[model samples]
Target: MKRVTGIGGIFIKARDTDALREWYSRHLGLDIADWGGVAFRWNDDNPGAVGTTVWSLFKADSAYFAPSDAPFMVNYRVADLHALLAALRDEGCNVIDRTDESEYGKFGWVVDPEGNKIELWQPPEGQ
Candidate 1:
């Protein structure tokens, strides 16, 4: 048997493609080049290092999330949790930033104009 390497890309449908592209570019600074897909670099380290994962966010009612109708979850690795949250808020985006050692590392979430939930996370130091 063989194992998978990593996620290739994430694709989603939009009523207004151009508008959504601009929204992501403005709010998240993601470069939606050809098909509104952003390439993000992941962290690979020693001892429980999560590889680069491409996560997509969709509406809770959308079929993309799951067959049972649940909110989409896309956890993105960010460099600075505070700065990212601040920048997102400055861009008029609703950012939820919370940190708890018991849980994961610093984490936050933001919704795009299309009502997609985008999660942001900052792993513990060296993780």
Candidate 2:
């Protein structure tokens, strides 16, 4: 029997679709069509990474983040935390870099144009 593999896509609601699409394209370099959502490119050479590239977003006010008061839309695993943070800032994106050495990994946060919180993570060596 076949089995499920990985994630498919992330669908986000936006107050202003045009503005949101433009913002992602401008800031994150994500090519979004007039009505199409964002599509992230992954390394083709990596066999371990074969699936739809996306991260879903749920209501933070709900039981998503547990007892935390802050809202967490999604957490993304990025390659270069510093470089990505810098690029996001340079493109006028709201980025919060709170890099702390922990057992988990280095982490940071960014908010999209639609005010959804996005978490960027850099995994530790030999994880």
Candidate 3:
């Protein structure tokens, strides 16, 4: 099984999220939405296969990356969340116990050796 197919998103914690968002929007020409993020869409070489990469900024004190103490978190796309998570556990990786499911897809997390939280996402079929 593929461990990580691709990067799903990059999230950063900033002392001033609003300021950072404005900076990215003005300097990088990112169409940041009210939610303080942007989704970049691209077409794969394969016909009709479109993919997206999300970029977002969060408040410095946000608990989203909790227990990791890292200012940033990386979300990786996976083909099978449950299977990959099981493999990670079998490999002795520190897989977080919590899981979430929603209209978006299934979600899970694991902390790297350096204590950076990693997000794993399996997008809903045909997404």
Candidate 4:
């Protein structure tokens, strides 16, 4: 099984999310929306194949990246969240004990050796 298929998203914590969002929108032309993020559509040439990569900024005090003092987190696309998480556990990685699922897809987390929380996602079928 492939450990990581691709980067699903990159999340950064900022002291002032609004200011950072404005900076990215004005300087980087990111089209940052009210939600403080943008989804970049995958330009796949293959028919019936589509995907997107998400970029977002979170407030400095946000607990989303909890258990880690890092200011950033990376979400990785995975083919099978359950299997991959199991493998990480067997390999002695500090896998988080909780999982979440929604219309978006199944989600799980694991903290790397350096204590950076990593998000694993299995996108809903056809996403």
Per-model TM-score, in order, reads: 0.45, 0.45, 0.95, 0.95
lDDT of 1 by residue, 2-103 (tens): 112233335454556677677888998876657346656555554555444443434334554332222435566677777777777888985544443434
Scored by lDDT, the top model is: 4
Model 1 TM: 0.45
> In model 3, how large is the Cα lDDT of residue 122?
92
Give the whole-model CA lDDT for all candidates, comma-separated.
0.55, 0.56, 0.90, 0.91
- Count of backbone clashes for each model? 0, 0, 0, 0
Tens-digit lDDT string for candidate 2 (1-127) = 1111222345454556567667777997886644466545554546654323553334334553332344434566666677778888888987764555577666677777776666666655433
Q: Tell me model 3's lDDT, rounded to 2 decimals.
A: 0.90
In Å, residue 82's CA in model 4 sits off its true spot by: 0.2
lDDT of 3 at 65: 98
Model 1, which residues run further than 4 Å from truth? 1-71, 97-103
The collision pairs in model 1 are: none
lDDT sort, best first: 4, 3, 2, 1
lDDT score for residue 62 of model 3: 95
The C-alpha RMSD of each candidate to the native structure, in angstroms, is 13.0, 13.0, 1.1, 1.3
Model 2 steric clash pairs: none
Model 3 clashing-pair count: 0
